[model samples]
Target: MTRHLPSRRQALLAGLALAAAGCAPLPRAGTASASSRQLPQERVRAAAPFPMPDISVPDFSASRRFPITDFGAAQGDQQKTSAAIAQAIAAAHAAGSGVVVVPEGVWPTAKIHLKSNVNLHVAKGATLLFSERPDDYLPAVMTTWEGLECYNYSPLVYAYGCDNVAITGEGTLKAKLDVWKVWYARPKPHMDALVALYHLAAKRVPVEQRQMAVGQANLRPQFVQFNRCRNVLVEDVSIVDSPFWVLHPYLSRDVVIRRVKVRAHGHNNDGVDPEMSQNVLVEDCVFDQGDDAISVKSGRDQDAWRLNVPSRNIIMRNCRVKNGHQLMAIGSELSGGVENVFVDNCHFDNAGSGARSTINNILFVKTNERRGGYVKNIHVSNVSATRIAGGVLSVETDVLYQWRDLVPTYERRLTPIEGLHVSNVKVDEAAFVCRIQGEAEMPVKDVSLRGVTVAKVLEAPVSTVNVQGFVHAA
Candidate 1:
């Protein structure tokens, strides 16, 4: 189901609300104090538009179908259906290239790992329900969590080292939330395991030696992940209640996620995380997420420096976000680098619920001193938002979370960010139009904002520190 954009009347109401709250617009380009010499009028510059990526989904014209029902699998029987589905996938893989059909029913299952040239298709009116038992995902697979590599629980649907893989159908992929909800609390054991994993990753231990599924690690796996795969496509699926990140494509290339709907308002349930992957496109999607709607990430710390693969040529367009922290976020784990990202013609709905009842920001770039990566060539344009509780744009360099106090900064590496452009954007209400805090030594540079309008802002419209060549012009 496609989400509808807010009407002009709604936008007007939002503007009126901000005005009633006594919010005012900031001064335009030339009206800053002498002490704020860094934010000069000449600093604002026009940005050249980035070219749209040329990407397409793979053609499966010659593929045959391998239906699960033909292999003795019935609905509601978790164990039997899970095995039967696996068998169907194997059969399709063995047959060169084929589609594995999941018929119309609520098929409860365990973990499902895809092979090359396999398309897992769930038919209309069907739900691929995952099991609530933790043991179902035992014998951990090689996966990354927050940026470190370790052997953790297998994702609900995983594809590793595959080619021409797709999960395309008009059906739902849901998680049995009873177990995952408990794991979200991050108890003592979970924190301890996280710290232990950080030490192992920082020390540059072999990935195979960093086992993490045992003990109380309880590291929640992603709902679906394509790891080190190429030519991947995920479309027309309604995902609900993810255990972790909803859709993750790590170290993959030529990936496309389009015409999808994700509603996973659980902890760490980012709608889509394109990590260390290149040539990616996410378009025509709807997201109601617990975290950032779309987060561009690379590797972390030593692990990232070893791989040295940056996430580039990523694009998100024609999307709508009902609830999210940031419509688009970069980093906190971007050690390898994130560049050449383009977001266009998207809408963010500030009408959220519970703790996120107020939308945080439309775009946020967060990194810390410990994360040594670069973020560049980010272009966002033609965006609209009804309301935002926080700043419309924020570039923070000292956003250290739990790791700030938990673990000491073993290596003091700082990121260099530049070439950010936001143009032709509109918002009805916001706390601030821009809030940027760059490092003293490594200041952010070359940020340009043009043709942007915020009807009302409660706080200062533009706030900056140690930034140069930042232009704010209508």
Candidate 2:
């Protein structure tokens, strides 16, 4: 059964995080409908079916304890509030406490760095409202993504290379991301002030000379970033209106995310992105995003050439994707390859059209023009989707930069994907055209489809004759 453990530790921690972040005491849990119809009980899957193999992650439960903070009560600009909260967390860590409290209120602000072994909890009715003012998110940090270094907007709640960490609560954490429209990077200033944001990013003396604003990019940033973290838990929070990707667990392991709500329409506003990570679990979450709901990626081309990790052992269940690109997406970043992912009991409806853009692919995996690794061993079942405009299944690769002369040469030592299984998949509307291709040298092998039904059928069908490791191309 899909149980709602609203009062679980994660939720409790979310509530506490909000209080510490400076929100006021919550009135009552909002009664807004869950945004989508509940799927048949039989359709939902359990987390236990796909076991969590051993991975590296510290148990923060045994780390020094920390208390939450309230950002609303602090006076002066958002910098003051953020600084106060930051000090509180740092003090806790120095005292050997790992938890910091986030009190309730409409706490306004910008970039706030996260500490190690700290649990930032948000309470119900508490909202962390980030300011649209450009000067708020200041300074530059040399951060990496799947192992790429490009200057961009910093995450609102930024944490890099921490262990045994978590964020939980039942509250509204708002990032007035659309406010970026105020910058000059955009064409028109519509709902969000992107033009003003461009101006903020346009302070182009260059980081080599400019001190604080070196790493500001034109693209929006992730709201939550766990870069190379271990033993992470992000549970039971209502994360709304993110500026970019909501919950990103990148290059980490033994991560768990449950009962989280992320609603954002900003460019590249993915709900959850696990890049080059291992042993992950995402369950009972609701995603109303502008981009792919949940995406897995490893480095891309030149970036991929260096990273030595692949995403593996990923499990997802009882999750819903409302306005998104793909409910699940493996990527163009397959330079390091992806594998061992199981997704089931998910609902995708009213998707494709959202606040900002439309999605082009669902169940999307790409490795265009460039090749380094393989994507394989995926199992999906009991998924129901409605109102989708993109290709139902697209397994081909693409190259944004056209390189006509570059030959597509593959490798034998690649982590070739095998053992694919899909069943009980139902889609309401699809136009046509579904291509599930493996490398010509490694055309997907060993695929099984049982009790699978699609409302619209494409001319092409997926199948693979299997013996040992089945790698179905569908």
Candidate 3:
């Protein structure tokens, strides 16, 4: 359904040929615009093989500024800065609409909670360095670990049930990873705690009662999470380090993350994770991540099914990745279905990397039998990469990392993956072109590849176990 004309010349020729054959020419690019902003929503919708909504971000041009320094925040003191930030946020929220400003200096702080119609704007020469102490985020807040919902440590910047929130500026939001670096190691205690949480979620325990900040749970908090919010925008910020996933839009809607730069190399430091969210757009971002550059996820098994909100109408374009496991990954935690995702004009530039640092794949769709979600209408086009360590495309149905031995499967429901199309993807070197290991009962369906050229193949170009309607074109 999705078509990619690699170059302008190709597009022109294709249009001319279609006209000569008396067929309607391809729809011109950028015909439909969203709101007054210049985001190419029309192009995104055109690329998608399904219906996509017009995504828009919060506009704060008329908001007043409430600087943290005005509320007794100093550069060296953490307590004073944290209090000042809270006070500034309160003042801004009370003023109907405002921007809580962190001005030009290194400001140490703890958890920052955003309210509705508030913009947390860090100025050009400023850095909001989050504290490393676990106590700084104490008094557990409602958050998710991996994909399960619980009350845990609050993210560094947390937004809960707020509308029209924006975190925009030309500054940096960094984390002090002294304690989190140690928590990255999944010891026996950590694994046990995860199993306990899994059991709790499977049994449908109250989310408020599932406290995980106690004991050796070590479930590191995310850097920034828009939890249960609407009209979110995070733009032009440089994120350095993170405790977990860098930018997370969780159960939020109408989100836009653009012109941002992230360099986080922690345990599971994905760049931007849009989980259980709809109408999301991530464009013009540069990611140097420890995990996938952009991971599309819904909630986990039982928790996701209870919520029943599928992640859909998402688009990622014009992004660059320096280091990652994959350019984009869909679900190892997707139980609440994911569909209508379009990734275009993205590139992975990992040329000067060591062997262990090369990307594994361009696109990886992974789900196990425990996850009952469905993945469909995934389209990727015009993606180029320097080198891929594994393959260009991979769809593995039995990808349970540690849960296989740690805990028993409470419910067995296989994911239905179908309608995956990739076109005009050029990689310098790769282990293979495609590797699909689908289940016998429910094979992956309707996968097609066109113009997927790899310069060097370290292994077989294509491998499959159980797949239906598979097509490949050089």
Candidate 4:
């Protein structure tokens, strides 16, 4: 039933097959003009050596010119603990120095606003406990979600619009264990303090002179959110009990998140949501979460329809994902598109019950019917998965999660997906569903598997494939 459907894109992409062998070196900051900033063909660029792609650990161990603090201050003066830490950050950022060490024991604070160009390293036994009181996280900061301008509740450890940042060492960055996800998806009356402050900040009121709206206890609080930053690194930190999403990197570039551990029981608490970024590397991380682990997004359907920016050039290698909905996702919110990505050398291990747990795998693309954008040029390889609730691999152009009979059209869909490759993958057990489904008319191209092995399958049915060469385990 293959018909020669002629179209503008089919004609163009007829010659634009993904024979893309290598990647050209990343351009220096000032190389490309605003007009030629991004190459359209760059979308097909194969996974090449980014040559230490924009992340490195520069010996923050010995360069501890910054003073250290012990939160075990015998005097219960919150001001002393607060002032000493604030001065340390200011001094560290001022001196172009590194390491404001939070070494051992619990350091409780109302709000500890992080600064630019500094590393907050915590020792193995140390814990930075943030005050549950919402008033501490005041002074509305500049941030964005889905690239829209709005006064949203920011993170506990907030850094919006900075560069060369990090949070290193093995310890716990603890938020109030019981607060949970109080106000992220919805607004509350008590959150008027944060809202009013944002309203005032939006009105261009002076920060110091703005009225302090208090006694409110509602606002979406992420454990850590670094927005619109570059060359960022988050390494070797164990985070627990976040109020909302654990680590959110929104609208950033050239970021590396390594060896971080996240365990939380809050809803929508994804380990990392890399929204609208380029050249991102998330490796060697362990996530046991409440919602989808490390889901990637450009924006939700409607908002994403307008701001059609893709999450491109992403690599998640050597990571372990357990207790989460599909280890790596093209997204539920794929308004723009996701292209040229790879998730290799990862493991999926888990028990049973967490809100995020599901058919975890290396690749899970489900944007059916209400398609906002496309997911193209994806690869998953060298992975071993066990005890998955769903399938080893799945691709959907329509959703079975909720409503049906709604076909997302051209005006709705942002882009098209093509060029998918999977190799050297093994799945021990899938107790439920696993399959691939694209729009009957617009079949996904270049989808293949070279040494995939699967067993103990139960739910779902799969059939149609458009790839040229595909091999499956017997």
Candidate with best TM-score: 3
Residue by residue across 340-396, what tens digits does model 1's lDDT show? 998989998644433454458878999999989899999899999988888768999
Greater-TM-score candidate between 1 and 3: 3
TM values, all candidates: 0.88, 0.73, 0.90, 0.75
Q: How does each model score on lDDT?
A: 0.83, 0.60, 0.86, 0.62
Q: Write the per-residue lDDT of candidate 3 for residues 118-222, one digit (tens) a residue.
A: 789999999999999998998787799999998899899988766677898999999999999999997888888889999999998767678999988888999
Backbone clashes in model 3, listed as residue pairs? none
* TM-score quality measure for candidate 1: 0.88
- Residue 141 local lDDT, model 4: 48
Query: What tens-digit string does per-residue lDDT give for candidate 2 at 1-474?
Result: 122233365456445543443322222222211110111111222353455564333334444544333433453357676776677667654554355656666666677667555667666767777776555664544333323433445677776655455677786678775566433243332212322222222332122222323334344556788765555777788887766568878777668888998887766677888888888889899888778888888765444444457888888889987778888888766666788888889987764435543555457766664446778777777887765665555565444342223222332233344555676777766543345556555555555656655676544444222124433333
Residue 45 shift from truth in candidate 1, angstroms: 29
Off by over 4 Å in 3: 1-47, 351-356
Top-scoring candidate (lDDT): 3
**Where does candidate 3 have its weakest 10-residue lDDT segment?**
32-41
Clash counts for the predictions, in order:
1, 73, 0, 6
